[model samples]
Target: MTYCVGMKLDKGLVLMSDTRTNSGVDNISVFRKMFTWQVPGERIITLMTAGNLATTQAVISQLEERTKEPDERDNILLKTPTMFQVATEIGNLMRNIIGERQEANGVKGRGRFTASIIVAGQIKGMEPRLFMVYPEGNFIEASLDTPFFQIGETKYGRPIIIRGYDKQMSLEDGVKLLMVSFDSTLKANLSVGLPIDVQVIGRDEYEASHEHRISHDDSYFSAISAGWGDALKNAFHSLPDYSFYRGDD
Candidate 1:
């Protein structure tokens, strides 16, 4: 399992995904969940995956292959005319991969070969966009009402993003918000973990403004984790106490 978030902001787009994948407590592993395609000043596309590792890797490898052989008709990640089209092409690719695996595995593959992706980026002349692509090949774009998208082991950290996200927040704040959300998930679940991958795209820049990884020993993330725990405890203590008796208020 994993946790990945793609957020749409007034400044542009911010994305982060954890690297942990595990079949059981004894079989934990870390593999990068984020993949990016950039054409310098013309466009930049980022994708994060969660689900069956094989399926996700297949999807990415196919994409990489297309980029290498740009003459290939299906080379759309870089060739797609719009961010929306990019989402469509990716959804189709994932759906096809799952379908193929399921057909090959028969009953055994009923639910085994599935995955979801969060894709975010911009094309030079078009507006920056963010999308969540599902195994079914359908997707939803982020907007004012739902300004962010999360996939995989999402429950533990979602509320944090809901409470802190602001469409106009700066990329710096967005990163902080993701750090807190990821820290919360790490503490609650072993399936989602450290060495997170993050990317920030500034509006109209047609490229990534910031991209980096948060390692296990990153001092800033450590501070945020400790600080949040203390703040939560203080907030809980400061809340008005309830009384067992009716007159105690």
Candidate 2:
């Protein structure tokens, strides 16, 4: 399991993903869930994946292969004129890969070989965009009404984002918001462990503006985790006491 988030802000985009994967309690491993492609000043794309590792890896592999032989293939990531087209190509590729696996296995019901992705980035002449791609190859983009997307082990961390996300927040605040969400998730679920990968893309930069890998011992994350817990407890205590209760009865 993993926890990945992509935020579309007025300033640019912020993305984060945890690196833990496990088959069982006794069998655990770490594999990066974030991938990026760039053409220097022309374009930059970042993909954060969740669900079946094999399927996600295969999808990324095929995309990379296309980039290597752009002349022989459509290579939508490189050749597409707009971010929307790039998303369409990725969705098509993802659907095809899952279909092939299903046929090979001859299975019907939703099985283990399914995956989802969060695609975020910007092109030279376009605004930064963010998308959440489902296992069925369909996707939804982030807008003013929905400025962010989360995938994999999402429930544990969702409230923090819903309460704190601001369209005008700076990139620094965006990263901090994500950290709180991730910290909440890490505390509640065993499947989503860290060292988290984070990237910030500034509007019009067409390249990564900042990237970070936060480990278990990171002081800033530690402070945020502890501070949130304390704040929650303090808020709970400060709330007005119930008036209907009879304490001595």
Candidate 3:
């Protein structure tokens, strides 16, 4: 399992993904789930994946190969004029990968290699876009009402994003919000471990403007984890307690 989050802000996009993958309690290992492609001053794209590792890796490998071996194959990832088409191409690749795997493995393989992806980027002269692409090759864009997307162990961290996100917030604030959300999930789940990767793409920047990796011993993350724990304790204690019966005393 994994926990990957991508947020769309009025300023730009912020993405974070855990590097943890586990086959068993003693078999845990780290693997990066975030991939980015960019042509400075023209376009930039970032993808965060969750689900079966093999399927996700295959999809990424194919995309990476196409970009590098453009003479032998079309590099739609770079040549596409719109982000929508970029997403369309990726969705097609994911669908093809899953279909082929299932076909080769027989009926027992259905749904075994499914994966999900969040795609975000900007093209010159066009507004920044964010999308959550399903395993079925369909996707939906982020809008004002839904300004972010989460994949993997999303349930544990979703409330923080729902409560704290504001489109007008600064990029720095956006990063802090995501860190807290990831911290919460880390505390509640074992599969979503650290050495988390973060990327920020400022609107119209045409590339990632900032990138950071949060390691297990990262002082700032440790502080955030501890401080948030204390804050939650304080908040819980401050709430009024309810009486079981009116006028019982």
Best by lDDT: 3
What is the per-residue lDDT of model 1 for residues 20-121, given as tens digits with 9 covering 90 to 100? 999988899989999989888999999999999999999998877744656654545888899898899899999999999898878344488989999999
Give candidate 3 regions above 4 Å deviation. 66-74, 108-110, 245-249
Q: Provide the TM-score for each candidate, comma-separated.
A: 0.93, 0.92, 0.93
Tens digit of per-residue lDDT, candidate 2, span 106-195: 967576788898999899988898998888888999999999999999999999899999999999999999999999999999999989
Using alpha carbons, what is the TM-score of model 3?
0.93
- The whole-model C-alpha lDDT of candidate 3 against the native structure comes to 0.91
Ranked by lDDT from best down, the candidates are: 3, 2, 1
lDDT of candidate model 2 versus the reference: 0.90
Writing each residue's lDDT as its tens digit, candidate 3 over 1-249 gives 899999999999999999999987789999999998888999998899998899999998888674565567654578888999988989999989998888888834448889999999999999999999988888999999999999999998999899999999999999999999999999999989999999999998999999999997899989999999899899889998788876867
Q: Who is ahead in TM-score, 2 or 3? A: 3
Model 1 residue 53 CA deviation in Å: 0.8
